[model samples]
Target: MKNFKIVFTFVLFLLFSFSNAQKIGVVDTEYILNKLPQYKEAEARLNAQIDTWQSELQNLQAEYEKKRSAFENERVLLVGDQLKLREKEVMDLDKNIKTTTSLRFGANGEITKLRSNLVEPFQDEIYSAIRAVVDKNGLGIVLDKNKDNVISHLPRYDYTDKVLDILLKGSDKKEKTNSKGKK
Candidate 1:
């Protein structure tokens, strides 16, 4: 009976201590991004750019294949410096294709740069909106519910709509301000 009382008292004490603590909130960044029109447009533009680059890479590879086949067939027929020059041409074309591919789509390449340029602005806006919500609500912590380790959370604790609201509201305010300033 005494042990039960002690455990019960400890539970009550913990509850009381936590009652005054700052609240925790969760935001789904993907959900918030989806709510932003600019994000959708940026994603579409990035995907289109990626497709164009991929097609170009494919064309380069095809050209390299043709050159390689031609060189293999004529290699035995040619002799001396003529054979060497043709082989060198094929090798240089292959090297140029690899260099182009690396420059366009490799790690830390043009694709990454384009994605950053397109998406970073929306990311910044989302972060600022989340920060504003946290500061205004006196939240102690804000977790991204999109993260893998977050298995479950209460719906009431989810602040995804609040973040979207803030972002949309900010944009609306900007539009209104711009219109008024024009007149």
Candidate 2:
């Protein structure tokens, strides 16, 4: 189904491309992001967070294993109430670890939220820059070459560098404003 969507989008892009002599532009958002220093910093921060989460998860798993091992070792000698309590403690710890792992790493989890928080502003800026580029170029259709939407694209039609330039210009303007205020 996903492949079908990709193929369909590709077909539409080609169709639109050949339909008229109107200029069609291609923007690679990934390339644009890669050029931004801010994106690199955000990526580094995200990687650090992922590393921390992985270490924390490993510690949790280790703690769970210890509790489970002790419970198993003492189960034979434990009386009714004591055995039940030990069993419950082990079970609860296992459950807690699972929940914590999922909360940190699963879909729509904290890591995902953090990633979005870090990347969304960059994406928005890219989008706006792409729009400005399209408007300036009088583009009829814009296809993303990065997502396999285009099997091949001519260098002439690629507006990624132009869009990146616009994005950088906007970033420069912001920096100048911020510096002026700071001083």
- Give the poorly placed runs of model 2, Cα more than 4 Å off: 1-20
Residue range with the least summed lDDT across 10 consecutive positions in model 1: 143-152
RMSD of 2: 10.5
Off by more than 4 A, model 1: 1-16, 177-183
Clashing pairs in 2: none
lDDT of 2 by residue, 1-183 (tens): 999999999999999978867787888888889999989998999999999999988998999899999999988999999999999999998998889888999998899999999999998888898889888989978998788988887899999999999988888998999999999
Cα error, residue 70 of model 1, in Å, equals 0.9
- How many backbone overlaps does candidate 1 show? 0
Candidates in order have lDDT scores of 0.90, 0.91
lDDT of 1 by residue, 38-110 (tens): 7898899889989999998899899989989999999899999999999999999899888988898899889
- lDDT at position 122, candidate 2: 92
How many Å off is the CA of 145 in candidate 2?
1.6
TM-score of decoy 2: 0.85
